[model samples]
Target: MRGHLPNAARIIDGFHVVKHANEAVDKASKAEAGENPPLKRTKYLWPGNESNLTDPRPEVRRDPAKRRSKTARACGMRERLQDIHADSANRTEAEAGSKALRSWMMHSRPEPMKALAGQFRRHRQDILAYFDRPYTNAILEGLNSIIQHAKTRSRGFRNMDHSGTMIYLTCGELGLNTVTA
Candidate 1:
């Protein structure tokens, strides 16, 4: 589409991009956990917020050594990336954050994170565009999920129109009293 619409701005959803990084962190955590006995039942450590590391939960607070492992480093990277996304108030900040993320990814020990960094580098421009608009397809994705659930609960829609109506009723957020009036 970029070839056909030269003037159009391309944007990548920040949430989606960060999900890849999170996946890498999870992978690293699983690998590390498998090798270490203490970390065996602590799979929840990696995906948790950085603050959760100090939480009162025995699983989290009990293991200081777990926080020093390679998985922790990967989780740290994930947390930093999340901070970058949250801190970017404008395009310039976003650009700087993206650069920092790229640098961190390049040095990251996990192969998956390195590959994710390469992907971000390739689409850097589109990813940066997200700072300008701050819009994401998350809402659409949620609606799609709801529609799928609706379809599954009812077995299937008889046709396209039925499916469309189901989706509209589920996702349109309509006021029935007003519509009836």
Candidate 2:
């Protein structure tokens, strides 16, 4: 990107980074579940913000800090990274947070998280660039999701023209003045 678009701010979306971190945590949980009984059926509890955790059991919610499994540790680390992203208002703060997270993950026990640490090292600049230019492809992703839903609802449109029209109709916000002026 730097070769062609010299002036472009190459940013790595924080959302994607956190997503991969959650995936890594999930992978860690799966691997650890074999040796650890507590983690056996808790696969669904690993992914998502630490605050909005989805586990229905009240005991599970209160006892996370007591659990010392790799999965729990990985979840904590992922949450820390998410918090860093949320709190960082400038590149300096983000870089500092990234450095701390990278070091912690690099030394952490989970293999998947260690791999994620390597990723952070390689894409440090791109990740920090997000703080420099806070922009995300969320709108595009949402539009694409809407279009996909529209396509699914249509269940294979008759032709390309119809597909295109369906996508536009699903995604576009058209103003219809029904009342006569």
Candidate 3:
């Protein structure tokens, strides 16, 4: 498709990009948790919003005396990545944000985070496309979820025709009220 549509803008979904960073944090947290009994039940710490840390669920909240660990540092990095998206106003800003994030992740100790950074570096152009036009696949993904649910409820369709019709009925904004009964 890229070959045929050479002029088309390539946009990567922001959600998927953030998901990768979150996964890296999760991996680090899991590894740290294995050796540290205190972190055993702290899996929720990395995935939750930074604001949650101040008023977190009883299980995940950090004690005042306990110093922040490498997992916490990884979580902080994830927050920084999210902030880059939220704060950037244009492509130039996004480029700077991406550079900062890449540099930080490159030096990060977590292997997963370093791998994610490498991915960002390789796909830098697609990732930066978000700033050029703030578009996401969220709507399509939502509609897909609805279609999948309908398919599951019906125990799967026997043919693509049935599936396609179901998708259109559920997702297509057809003005049925204007049609005659």
Candidate 4:
């Protein structure tokens, strides 16, 4: 989305959100010349919601326009990346806004699914950012892929919250929110 919908105010990727965080972390491994830290290691690397997350992901989390080492000029679509930063450098405030979302969920008094909740918050921007932009795309087709995949890979919902979270998170990824995803 950072590439395809850079100008778009709100580009909701209900399906891509989940993969991006993990991808960020994965991408960080190859970025050695940048200031942004790589994907977070360990589940609880970030402290409770206070402010100023020391987690390495923050630097990796900043907007591309903010990247100090960005050397990409007004180039055409990039198919492959040279460094881990290629993701962050091309990212938007919406995609970068996951820091706040993750913070909110991590500190939830009753901590829903700290892990998955963090995942949702981490990608909140990419999911909700669609509303900010003029163009709104459909992601339900992709979300269906997740639902079908989940059902085949795992058993039925263990609990309603987990089930709801899975559905909501998937909706956010697929850009489908029947009930305010």
Query: TM-score of each candidate?
Result: 0.77, 0.81, 0.81, 0.22
**Candidate 3 residue-wise lDDT at 132:** 88
TM-score of candidate 4 to 2 decimals: 0.22
lDDT of each: 0.76, 0.82, 0.79, 0.40
Q: How many residue pairs in model 1 have overlapping backbones?
A: 0
Model 3 TM-score on a 0 to 1 scale: 0.81
Cα-based lDDT at residue 151, candidate 2: 85
Provide the lDDT at 17 for model 1.
Answer: 74
Per residue, candidate 3 scores C-alpha lDDT tens digits across 12-114 of 8578889988999899888888776767777876687757555545335455322266687777788888888888888899899889888988997777888
lDDT of 2 by residue, 9-107 (tens): 767898899988988998998899888876767787677655676546435834654267888888889989998999998999988988998899999
In model 3, what are the clashing residue pairs, if there are any? none
**Residue 131 in candidate 1, Cα distance off native in Å:** 0.8
Taking the tens digit of each residue's C-alpha lDDT, what string does model 1 give over 63-136? 67876777777777787888888887898988887798789878977676787789889988898888887788
Who is ahead in lDDT, 1 or 4?
1
Extract clashing residue pairs from model 2.
none
lDDT per residue, candidate 4, 45-101, as tens digits?
A: 222121345756455334364232221110100111112122343346434444544
Model 2 is weakest, by summed lDDT over 10 consecutive residues, at: 172-181
